[model samples]
Target: MNMSTELIGMVAGGVSTAAFLPQALRIWMTKNARDISLLTYCILGLGNVFWIIYGIEKSSLSLVFTNSFILITALVIVYMKYFIIKD
Candidate 1:
């Protein structure tokens, strides 16, 4: 609620969301995810989904928004690993 707490939350959310952007962009551009771990992404995506659910239940905007974005990225990676790479 305080300015400092809000700032920290925004920063944390921004950083966490941004962390996955490069990997998503790489997969989108290269059309390759051969080296990516399918299991890891699957687990991470599931975890992201749970976080989104928790965020919704708790009414936490930061958690919801950040985890939703992460979920999207995770799904993309999973798709690439399974479908695009084809290996």
Candidate 2:
């Protein structure tokens, strides 16, 4: 990949990855996820997992990195939805 394309990928990945930080931080701070949708996150997380596999198959670093971060964030949301809120 050219440096310009790689740079774009990194920038896009950074922005997309950052998208989950706020929600994760909110859940961490408030310890409340009652308003979050469990099924939505579950599906999103699963989708991220598939994206990771696709990234691996295609050898796309941007896809791997972005999807991996998204998957982590999605897992946190799902965990909060199922486990934390249940308590």
Candidate 3:
């Protein structure tokens, strides 16, 4: 991978990973995940796990890092929805 390609991957990964932060933060601060779909986030977390495995197999740092962060965020939302919030 050339410098430019690697840079692009990093930038893309950063942006995508950052996209989940707001939702996680909102759920954490508000302690409400009623509006968030549990099924969707659960599926997303599963997908992220698979992606992490693939990234590891391929030795792609960007993929591994990005999916890990997203997976954590998804798990947080899932936990909040299922465990923390009653509704």
RMSD of each: 2.0, 1.6, 1.5
lDDT by residue (1-87, candidate 2, tens digit) is 677886798799999899889998988788888788778888888888998898889778898899999988888788777877664
The list of candidate 3 runs beyond 4 A from truth reads none
Query: For residues 42-85, could you state the per-residue lDDT of candidate 1 as single tens digits?
Result: 89888989998987887677788888888888887787777776
lDDT of 3 by residue, 1-87 (tens): 567776787789899989988988898888888899878888999999999999899778888888998998888778888888786
> Using Cα atoms with residue i matched to residue i, what is each candidate's TM-score against the true structure?
0.80, 0.85, 0.86
Q: Comparing candidate 2 with candidate 3, which one achieves the higher lDDT?
A: 3
Query: Which 10 consecutive residues of model 1 have the lowest summed lDDT?
Result: 1-10
Candidate 2 overall lDDT versus native: 0.85
lDDT of 2 at 25: 91
Off by over 4 Å in 2: none
Q: Residue pairs in steric clash, candidate 3?
A: none
If ranked by TM-score, best first, what sequence of candidates would result?
Answer: 3, 2, 1
Alpha carbon lDDT at 65, candidate 3: 87
